[model samples]
Target: MAMAVPAQTIAGYDRFPWDAILLQTNSALMNNTDPNVWASQIISTLRSTAVTLPSVDLAHRLVSHLFWNHHSPIAWKLLDIAASLNLLPPLLLVALLSTRIVPMRKVYPQAYRLYLELVKQYVLMLQFRNNSPNYEMIMESIDNVLQLSQVYSHKVCEPGVALVEFVFSILWQLLEAILDDEGLLDHVPENKPRWLSRSHDMDIAEHDCINEMKTEQKEGMQRKNTMIAIEIIVQLLQNKMTSRLLCLVHRNMPSYWGSFNHQMQLIASKSSILKNLKHITADTLLSLMENIHGVVSCNTKSKLESNVVIPAGSQIAFGGQCEGSSWSSIWLPIDLILEDALDGGHVAALSAIEIITGMNV
Candidate 1:
């Protein structure tokens, strides 16, 4: 019989090969001609590892190194590998979120395509109920992506349009999920509970405190996500990409818009989302108007029935001494489109104008 190796000795032996493989992988990542092949080899090695080390950690390290080095080709190849393996490691996601497009575009002309792919993978991961190790970390990564997009909106290229669309869709779905879970549509309680005894009151107080903390935390996250969504919309409008943006909203409006609008109303009622909305410049609004007119004109020329409609009774009422209601509703996009068509003096705009005028009359 062959002699059994000592556990410590076997572990030491195992560490050497892994270390060597890691070193080789790093070196190869820098100069590999075929990134997919290199990525495949790295992934195979990682999956083949028999040790107790987590695969995600290894993935994180590789992604972190590729990002730090600005290795776009290899980084994208790794992303493809990760997607194929259905492994969306939070660390890798964070690294992708933090990678700035300006720098990557300077290095690689195809950076936008890679970024789009990353966004697509993020959307897929979010849509599917994968067993992500940490849901909070994934959410944080998404927040980072949104923040990054807002900061770099001016630098957005053609491919980045798709990225924004995917990001917005994901945000809408996430908001819907949050609202469905919390039942935010229900009426708030008006009265406080009375205690039966001092000890009982103390226990109830403690429980209330914990519950309040949890609610506050969830509310904070909702506020942040809402702000990011608004920022993205504003940025897209500023970039003169409103037509495509409107198209995306129109497509998803039927299924998610009601819940999404309700959530937005709740957010605006409590937070600074409305304040931010007030700051949108007139020029941006005019640009959005022009884009909407173009969309309406095209629909008329093609004889297509437009599904876009600024639903009636979508007024937003502000709290406490705010006398008049505002048009800062979540359905503001529809309102903009209608305003454009009614005001635009073109034959193509006539049909839409008549429809709205008849509805109001």
Candidate 2:
């Protein structure tokens, strides 16, 4: 808020050209001249990527402009220029900024360069290895914040207003970093392993907060690199980057799985994604029930070969054993009364009678 807006200008990295375009775009929006058209062209420019291109800088710039617009009115004008020139931001970058945790070395070397150069303080690299769906739910929360009435009532968060997407992206970063590296934020003990730390995440109440909240922005890459962390998290999940996240979450918070259990119930209730995932829910529930039952009853491991993600289109088998045609449960031993009880104590005569009749009831 302290920095005054500057004259519109163009800025570009070695690969992507965007700083100049953003200035033009913001000028159009602020001046109320063809804002919608400029917005449309910006999105179009991004979508029509020349797949032949070597780097993602232009794409980065176009999207970056969205966040830079409010602080730098000139950047907004530059975004319009990028749109007019058919330049695009990176899709992967947008996705990274969405909800998953990503490492800087893997996702954004350019940004990482800036982080290392401008930030003399050493930064730790940590991965919160729990790949649990709670992170996915966290993403859903972020999406909701973007669509809040005060922010946007549209069905989905759209591009045009860079600030809106930029803000939402920041929320995701806060969640990822807090979940992965809370120590950096001064909220958790720096000596503790990063995965053990956590911070308050974005919520419904915050979504409804006033515009002044924008004035309360945090310092440096914290704002810009928020989505990058999340996008990596998503990439890991999609690519099944399982272990790191698992170790981070489960090892630190064993009970975190308990929270995942609740997600099954929550998702099943009219959430379309959950509605279609009933089988996974059932299998997860079955496994938990079986695991707990075994530990309680036998006082040890289940020894049962049940897996978490069930094989496709298979039901939970009530009867054990792999009999192809027919299977039966072995009857339990029981003592019968009547004459047999008396005969056991007594009777050589009864034994002889049963031997002759071939009946041992």
Candidate 3:
């Protein structure tokens, strides 16, 4: 018979070098002269451990200091390393999503690019994990992004647009991954019509049986996760800030809008919980159009009457008049112009005008 090992000895064998590894990594991050080399070392160490040490807080603080002090590339490199380890602390994620980064995107585009890459890595890491302990952190980060969008709304700057776009992309990716993993894409078969007997009681019993089956399915863990994801998306859609951000994205980024629209259509068509998303999407688009009409109407009202003069040597003619010297030009009202532009198969023209006017249509 083999000798029995002491309980303390077995416990020691199971223990990892959490403190030693974290200390050495923190020291390397702090004192290493070359950021690239240190980043490589950090990545190697994290991969070897295969666990996110709570002591990664030291690395988090160091990255925050670098980010604030204008060494964002290095900061982002460190963040990438952390994200690969799935060690992004909740507080750090919230900090990165803060409103403070809005201006940085414009002033330091390269650093901003690095920041985006870091965020993408974090999202990928989250997606790879099935049971993410950082779910609450991710949710808080979403709220932080929403808050940043709200703050950016008040500013008259282009930087906010990039921030809003980034937020929308990240939120969509994270939620889509969660929804996909939870099997929200699985087709829910429609309840078959039962053969009705002459008696009404039979019909009632059949309906009751269908309802019970439906309830049982809805109560499963997968269904619960799917519902939670749908609820989160719906809540975001209802939020004025996030909704406005998405509307702006829809108006500006056609490629992104097309892909996002396709995803929304998939969700609406496939998932029972997201059936109302189609209606919400329509309402959001209508609201965005109205907002465009209001802004364009206000800005162009004064310019419309004064600037109606047709340029000299122009081929264009209004109301069947060709090349006349200042024939009393009839001005089209803003509503009619919008109706003609939006309803008369000239949506491309309206989008161009919105872009030119910088009204975020």
- Model 1 regions more than 4 Å off: 1-21, 30-40, 47-56, 68-72, 90-98, 102-109, 121-126, 132-361
What's the TM-score of every candidate structure? Answer: 0.33, 0.25, 0.30
- TM for candidate 1 is 0.33
Ranking by TM-score: 1, 3, 2
Predictions in order: lDDT: 0.38, 0.30, 0.38
lDDT (10s digit) by residue, model 3, range 1-361:
0011222222343443344444454565466435346555544444445443322343444444454442423344445444434455523453443333322332333333343334433322222111244333333343344443343232322222333444465556434543354355333121310111122211212222224344444245334444444544554454433444454445444454555555555565555544444444434433443453123333334545676643322111112221213322443322222222232221121221112222110
Model 3: runs farther than 4 Å from truth?
A: 1-159, 182-219, 272-361
Error of 3 at 334 (Å): 27
Shift in Å, residue 226, candidate 3? 1.7
Q: For residues 18-101, what per-residue lDDT tens digits would candidate 2 score against the true structure? A: 433455566665765544566565444333333222123444544444432232333333332332233322222333223222
lDDT of 1 by residue, 211-254 (tens): 43456554554454444434444443333234434444433332
Which scores better on lDDT, 1 or 2?
1
Higher-scoring candidate on TM-score, 2 or 3: 3
Q: Which stretches of candidate 2 lie over 4 Å from their true place?
A: 1-20, 32-36, 39-55, 68-90, 95-361
